[model samples]
Target: MVLKNILHHRFFENFLKYRYLLTELVKRDIKVRYRRSVLGIFWSFLEPLLFMIVLTIIFSTLFSRSIENYPVFLLSGRLVFMYFSQSTNGAMRSIKMNSPILKKLYVPKYIYTIALTLSALVTFLLSLIVLVMVMLATGAPFTPYIALFIVPTVLLTVFNIGVGLILATINVFFRDMEHLYGVFLTLLMYSSAIFFPPDVIPVDFQWILTWNPVYAMISLTRDLFLYGQMFDTFTLIFATISAIASLVIGLVLFYKYQDKFILHV
Candidate 1:
């Protein structure tokens, strides 16, 4: 009975009640993102494709000997990092961005962060079409392992939501967080080995790649999609732990401080 009551608690009730609003918020975010753009949603398809082309052109001579089908390798890692970067950034700004509606309404504050992340997820999924096209064009073989790509994708999304919640909570208090996080993301992108291979890192620094959840996810996807193999046990275990820990920490902080958000925002 206690579990049942908890399951249907008013918190969950509010989510169900406001579910429609969440859907509208996600739609609005996507529409507003491309509002004045020429190609609008198609940019989702083109942006990653263009980025992959440029990176392949620039780095092909340097790393092509080490990485086979370099375009696929680069695109797989780039897409995962791009989603993490975009989703987390959007979620960080979500609370402040929707302050006007928040002040006048009683909707759950976390909804804004979730809507932003989901919108980014929608964009990321669309970009995968470009990944598929590149894979076929480059003659990267499709294997049954490709289906396992969903495992890392789901874990990465959970990790993003967790990190997004924490960032949103902090950003509410510190306006400078926006700029600071941009710098951190730049560092993170470099550390993720998106454009380079793990072997490029010195032997002493290999643990940086091993412990980095973002890189773990990227490497996992690359294993499935590019290399046609299952991800190693350590990467899977570490990524799972990282994702769950982030979510737990993010939830604890966000809920503990959420009531104070209106004062700061």
Candidate 2:
């Protein structure tokens, strides 16, 4: 019942009404991001490729014997983490940066954040192609399990939008939130099993990975794409619930404070 009410809310109605506008905004964001760049869209493909090289070199030297298909494992986590980090960070600045558009037109505020996030999603998808190429280059098998890749990809996208909403809302009031978030992302990256396996971390502190949303996301993707491991129902449920909860709370908070945004920005 409560969910039905939320679905019919005025804000959501306006969001749907302005759906075309949102699409335009997303297109503009992508074009603007690569506006003057020489490489343009190819930069998206290059970023993950470069990171895969650097991380593979450093981590492989440390744990290559212990971990098979280390490059595939590292690249999968790196690309997903980069998507979340980049999406939230871009959405964080969307409102303030586009204050002119907000002030001039009376559109749903959430559209900006949504557009920014979708733009990042586009880039993330592009970067994922690099991961696929690396997997082939490294002779990783294409098992039937690989078909399940969409499950975690969709979950992670939802998680990114949720986190983006929260960050965009907070950054409106406190600009320093992005700076703090950057530092936090650094900690998250190192601790989330991006380059190293969880076993390397002290067993006592491994719970960090156990409870981490991003780690769960990365691990799930790796399990399907690289390891051919069976899915863990508990982990899937936990991660899905976390993503939905974040989206709901974020939407509620953003809706509550949305009216006040124009005044501040």
Candidate 3:
């Protein structure tokens, strides 16, 4: 019955309109990120740059024998990991952050989720440019196969959207989700092989990393950058299912908790 209303609702019918609003919200988020800073958009350049420099120094000096070209290696994994993290982390607090809009507008509310995702996507593009520049300067292999990365890139977007949707809905009731997310995401970064090669992780625990969807997502990006071939098709398919499931759950939970947000927040 609830599904019937969702199907029949005018907002559902006019999804393109909602999607356009999401674009505007994304734009607002991008501008607000740099509002008063003297450096403005340049600040976005600092984070990934510093991260690459710090890690490059640490890995090159400490683990020189184990990993080669750690700068390029980590950059490949970190960029993809950063996108997934940014999308989910931004989305978790999206509902609360947009309180003014929620209070004033009787909009379908899912618009906020879409908006936050779009905002993260803006940064994702900006960061990718810097990543490409570093790759070319460092003499990382350039290949025609890099173009094929669009498939998994799109897949990652859907996967994150599903997970982000679910988390944002729950956050309305349990504000602690936001605080706890940092810890979860930190551990997630390690598990995704952003810092070290998967080989270094213990053999017994290797499946934990190999089976993880985040790991596969990172692997896809690495293949696009390092090798000129598609990778791990079975894992990719499984991850796609996981992503779709996440979205369905997130949407359902959001709709279920829609009434409680006004009371709780």
Q: Which regions of candidate 3 fall more than 4 Å away from where they truly are?
A: 1-12, 61-68
For model 3 the TM-score comes to 0.90
Q: How much is 64 displaced in model 3, in angstroms?
A: 4.4
Better of 2 and 3 by lDDT: 2
The runs of at least 3 residues in candidate 1 whose Cα sits more than 4 Å from the true structure, single-residue gaps closed, are: 1-5
TM-score of each: 0.97, 0.95, 0.90
Winning candidate number (lDDT): 1
* CA lDDT for candidate 1: 0.91
Model with the higher TM-score, candidate 1 or 2: 1
Clash count in backbone of candidate 1: 0
Which of the numbered candidates is closest to the native, going by highest TM-score? 1
Model 1 superposed RMSD (Cα): 1.2
**Least accurate 10 contiguous residues by lDDT in model 3:** 60-69
Task: Give lDDT tens digits, candidate 1, residues 155-209.
Answer: 9989999999999999999999999999999998888899998899999988888
Q: Cα miss at 125, model 3 (Å)?
A: 1.5
